[model samples]
Target: MVEALNKFQLIGQEQTRRYWETLIGSGRFGHAHILSGHSGVGKDALAFFIAAALNCKADTKKPCGNCISCRQFLNLENQALQLIFALPRRSANQTDPFTGIKEKEMILINEELAKKAAWPYYHLQIDAANDIRIAGIRKLRKDIYLAIDPGTTRVIIILRAHKMNMEAANALLKILEEPPAGTIFLLTTEYADRLPDTIRSRCALHHVPDLNWKLIREDLLQKKGVDPVQAEICARMSMGDLAAAHGYAEQDNTFWLDRIRATLNTLAKEDFVSVHKQVLLLADKEEQTDDSRQQFLSLLILFFRDVALKVKMGETVLWATQSQQMNKLFPNCDSQGAIKAIERTKNALERKVHLQLALTALFFELRKHLRR
Candidate 1:
């Protein structure tokens, strides 16, 4: 059974793989397991792999992904595997209200699965009420009580488990307390603290760590077919989050990079013209989305981090292509100041403060750091 974990293909988190393999193999596997970690880490992926391995009929090569059970799980088409995720309840414009809401949710969930099938690093995005409602859980409770095909292990994965509504969480807790034999509950969450203590206590907990930069860099190049330099950049920017690195590679990231470069320059020089230009550009289509804005801010943080590296390790910066700027401003740039600036900007955004004003303040503060 331990050998099975070594055979698993999950990148990074080797410890977690071994632990689960041992638990399942020893017949000590808990009915519920909680995979807790940062968003975009491989928590969901690891959970799915464990579920697949448990359900597969392979004798030694547990998830010999070639088997029917393994293949179905890989495709997320396994009848025994149930995937649950948050979907907004209903839209204001939903006409039928009852059927329309359920139909819409199903459509969105199918779309999410399609994305996952095509891109292994996809994160489900539900536009409406992003919480698992009691209705879904009640149905699950009923379904789990029903019959199971003999050798088929029923594995239910509740993704973004932290988003479960209170009622849903309570309902799930009851099931966890007395889970049926051959049924497994795998819950993945970025915020395990939000789960009730009773729910957390019922499940075996696995902490998923971020993949290291080297692994991410190699994965991006080998698995994702990204070019060397761009792959390195994406991996560095992603900071061990493969999902984000893949997204950075898939999109024409230059759109954001160019703006980010411009903004960085404005911050360095306290240039009124460039700052004003950025405000208008960012307010428009390209930089408007929260994802875009967060990416932009993350890039800014990385840029300063590179500046710090440039000062500490001459001729070496993460974004080697941006060395000219790093040399120009960050020769004496305070790393603490850069960190402070990043914290301020991140806090402002998290608090839902005015984006433009927050960014304006960030630039002003950054100017002091780079100038100092």
Candidate 2:
């Protein structure tokens, strides 16, 4: 039997891996753990690995990758895995957690989950999902107490746990305080501080630090078959987010940068006609997926950051070619206001606001900020 479990390409965090392996091997790990970290740092991946280890059927070693249980976990077909995350709001009188979810929304959620299962580092997204509602937690409370096989551990993972509203958070707190036997809770969030203090106090916090830039670049080049030049650019632009770096590797960075340049000029000139056209293009389902939309927004933010760098340090990093035009347009760019507006738009998008409306508002906000 293999003594060491396969990491499944879970990249770095040697210390975190060693700690969990030892604890899980000893069969004395805590009932609850919160994997807190910035985006794309493998918090969810680590949590999934730990959950797999806990439920692995190998007698002498945990997560013996060859076992039936491990195979199921890798395929995300493991019966023991329970995933919870933010979802769109249900009807006011709807008590069933999933009954109110529209068919398309459900399909999107499942697709994102499958992607995450295939690549542990992949970030999951559902366009309409915003917050974890109480009904889901209520259902979980019932499900946790159900009977399971002997020696099996039920793993419940709540991704983006900080999105839990007050009602759902309180409901989850009750479960953590007196968790059911043979069950484990793994909560992950980029914004752990946003979680209630009481909930934070109950779980063991494990901070997953950002991945190294060189390591990300290497992974893209070796495993992802990304071009060396593009890989380096994505790695640097990702800001230590490996998942974002992977996504960037697949995207046409130049195209997005060009779009941003054109959009910025329109916003600066207060051209509502062109601004509306840009919004329609951005919101086009035929042209942009939810992931692409998010990528576009991120690129826009980076573009503004480049402007700030150019204004403050006399040099722009990401798109030096565009720096000349941007300088000519806004000699004194108000990057602070522009960034704040982008953030507000990002928040609005997460809340399932209409894409056209959100992008339109963002353009107006940008016009206000960039006019100076």
Candidate 3:
């Protein structure tokens, strides 16, 4: 191995690794740091690695995974490592005519923490209790001021830090303002913009980049043992999400591809009626998974993107990779219209626009460009 195992379970995040090595190698590191990036980009893994490295007893290179300190950190058994994540007040399915399930909520959070200890990248994707409450923040505040672990540095890592409610954020800001010596606060968030400027400004922020296609390809082939052709397709579609790529490798996207091809047919004929029907189908699908609408929209965008690229760059189509004549099917398509639709739909969906209205407007715009 060219690189010594630095204790981070998550790989491919070069920026975080380089930053940790430099910080620890020079013996100069900050008290607080923010690891910001998209979800599944391994922000949590990076945090655990940094914490372990800081306390490792390796005489030369730090985070020697074999060292006793590194072992404790690896198992997440180190007392100096304080892990905090979002815990909601109740379950998302709690549609009961009552509020407050604090006990149940805490139990679920404990389960999530255990899962995280086993797999640091484990995201408590349970949307219900997804916030770092004021209570957790207060506990952190109390714990930090207490006596330090004699031999190691204290590492407080707050996963999904963006989930902190307003009160919790304020409480955290105070701790970040006047951080104690020998204590490092590692905060990880998928949405840094959700955090207030005051809290953001205090920490040394590092934006972890999305995983590249090359990295995903290597992982798919070597780790998952996926066939080369399918691996290429999965790598293409994952859009820098490791988890999504893994899912694509393991599961068939036949339904997803069929939907994309069906939508492409509507666009090919400039059939406004059919386009509206597709919108209706998507709107209906959203009921099962609230974000299914966006996922479908993402599929559409990819389709349009592939078509546009085929027209412009002569690249093989993703949906019809084997068909050399596929580009001809979209001769009347306005490349500009395709571009506009991708951007407009993406922006509208992100802003939480109503699906029917957004898709209706987009289809009309696309029809106008494609002609009569």
Among these predictions, the greatest lDDT belongs to: 2
Q: Which residue runs of candidate 3 sit more than 4 Å off their true CA positions?
A: 1-7, 90-108, 146-149, 217-238, 244-251, 262-293, 310-317, 320-333, 342-372
Q: What TM-score does model 3 achieve against the real structure? A: 0.75
lDDT of each: 0.74, 0.80, 0.71
Clashing pairs in model 2? none
What is residue 163's positional error in candidate 3, in angstroms?
2.4
TM-score of each: 0.78, 0.68, 0.75
Q: Over 4 Å off in model 1, which ranges?
A: 1-9, 87-108, 118-120, 127-129, 255-294, 310-318, 321-332, 349-364
Error of 1 at 14 (Å): 2.2
In model 1, which residue pairs have backbone atoms overlapping below 3 Å? 88-128, 88-129
- The window of 10 residues in a row where model 2 has the poorest summed lDDT is 310-319
Give the best candidate by TM-score.
Answer: 1
Superposed by TM-score, candidate 1 places the C-alpha of residue 170 at a distance from the truth, in angstroms, of: 1.8
